[model samples]
Target: MPVYVRGPKDIPDTVAQASAAASRVLQSIIKGKIIKSIKDMSLEKIETKAKE
Candidate 1:
């Protein structure tokens, strides 16, 4: 994933730091997807999958 950090010149840009941020972001997105997938509102029967 393309990682970007918005900070002043004092902030260090490193591979490890970028990777860590990317990991956290990916995790958060997946968690949010799963949470949203489980919350379905429909009157008819429908097939669904979680966190596709």
Candidate 2:
């Protein structure tokens, strides 16, 4: 997936670090598809898939 981390320079160091961590988690979870945005799917769909 195309993970875009924005405002790293403007935000605090911890914010950038957290964004990197979240990007890693997303990459690890969804390996096949390229997810541009979380809004593409419903929360229920995401929850159901996470269980699997």
Which candidate ranks first by TM-score, i.e. highest?
A: 2
Over 1-52, each residue of candidate 1 has an lDDT whose tens digit, in order, gives 9666865444455766888989987987887643444346453323343223
Give me the runs in candidate 1 sitting further than 4 Å from their true place. 1-13, 33-52
Per-residue lDDT tens digits for candidate 2, residues 1-52, read 8787864465577898898999988886688544567788999988876685
Residue 1, candidate 2: alpha-carbon lDDT: 88
State how far residue 37 of model 2 sits from its true place (Å): 26
Name the weakest run of 10 consecutive residues (lDDT summed) in model 1.
Answer: 43-52
- What is candidate 2's TM-score against the reference? 0.38
Q: Each candidate's TM vs. the true structure? A: 0.37, 0.38
Per-candidate clashes come to: 0, 0
